[model samples]
Target: MARGPVGQITRGTTGTNRLRRVDRWIARHPALRRAADPLVVDLGYGASGVTALELHARLARARPDVEVLGLEIDPERVSRARAQLELVRAGGASFAPDARVSFARGGFEVPVPGGRRPAVIRAFNVLRQYDEAEVPDAWSTMAARLSPDGLLVEGTCDEIGRIATWVAVGTDAAPRTLTVSLRLAGLQHPSIAAERLPKALIHHNVPGERVHAFLGALDSEWERAASVSPFGPVHRWRTALSALVDAGWPVRERSRWRLGEVTVPWEAVAPG
Candidate 1:
């Protein structure tokens, strides 16, 4: 008589290290670092649970007590992940045997046992398949399950994980920041991030939209900063991003430029 998971099944396309860009970002977030519970959820983790294991391994470097729970709506996926975990526990896998991780069957409702609310919920490429009109409700349903100071990181990335974009949503379901991370080596242009933008702003990347203008500026700066390419992509990125700061882009986190990352207030690209 119980109800079913609140979301739909996804294509389950996954690859090793495909989420490294995002995982590094989450490890530094306060929701995972300073949480009283330090419970992180990998919601809709596709057909494999390796991403969840990878997340735990990376985060544990910062929060040794961090716990990662991989949730999937399909019971079969849950079984498969548990089987993978068993190998890990038996020293047959690469991850630490005592890694604090688990697998569960759930969805956007984010069902967790022990009355524990997750400090961070990461749903990547889960909502991109849904219609744009349904994004808000999906975000609200997931964000509502977070702790008071928790964060909901939702985003999309390329198949190989070179380009990525995500939104940091608060417990109120209001988006706080938009981040674009790319592999600077042999990069074409920063505007390439537009193709991987999260669902909320993907369709709004047309002319007259704020996101479009932002990407335009990003590409323009990248092109203008080509003079520094001989030095290195990091130098090129810093030079380009510095120009944006001077041009009044309201870019945040100057230190992250070395990583080819740019974080801006959500309002910067919110749909007009």
Candidate 2:
């Protein structure tokens, strides 16, 4: 395999199932469900390969033939992931023996074997360390390596993965939508997701910015929906999201909003 451009090395702080929310979202994505090549890339899966293994397990439920490749810029991490794969193969781990997953040392270039581009690339918490100005170029580089109908899901989440936000970027490298997913049971406020916004808009969550206005609206709706909290957080959240849609926020479908999730077109919340 040709050496790709070396990207930044993250803290590699990975925890088991830390990416469940995003993985679930990706599993249900139409692009992956309908892809001719069901290859997914877990870009920068940290210190351990468990997240990649979990990704394979989760996505395999939707596409039994799905393949996952865990890419890390650090060679040591790649070697360690391969060792974990060996354990999985030997029945010493939770992953199935036939889990179609692999590890490689790669970065933004997304060097896949035989020049096969992936249908989906999940780059969670990868861009958090870079300057916001670099996000566009980084996104463009990865998007260029996608298959015809590929998707790039990039974002950040807390250490244990309760609250999360991600930007869905199309092959053109332009963000299509931004999704904020929270575990409503303990959600303090919908606007807390401002902290987990994708790198592109995290710093833009300030006065006069579109993202700021969006979050403010969400918080306001959350407060307005407080009367429904007697029913449940889920119902309260659904109500708030409905209010957002009613307020012309262009929120996505109710199916997603039901899961403590809300997505809006990038234009609705893009950085000003």
Q: Highest lDDT: which candidate?
A: 1
Candidate 2 lDDT over 1-272, as tens digits, reads 95554688999999888899999999999989999999999999999999999999999999999999999999999999999999999999878998999999999989899989899999999999899999999999999999999999999999999989999999999999999999999788888998889899999999999999999999999999999999999999999988988898999856977788898899999876
Error of 2 at 109 (Å): 0.3
Model 2 steric clash pairs? none
Misplaced by over 4 Å in model 1 are: none
Query: Clash number for model 1?
Result: 0
* Residues 1-272, model 1: lDDT tens digits: 99999999899988899999999999998788889999999999988999999999999999999999999998999999999999999999899999999999999999999889999999999999999999999999999999999999999999999999999999999999999999999998998998899999999999999999999999999999999899999999999999999999999988888998999999999999
Compared with the true structure, the alpha-carbon lDDT of candidate 1 equals 0.95
Worst 10 residues of 2 by lDDT: 2-11
Models 1 onward score TM values of: 0.99, 0.98
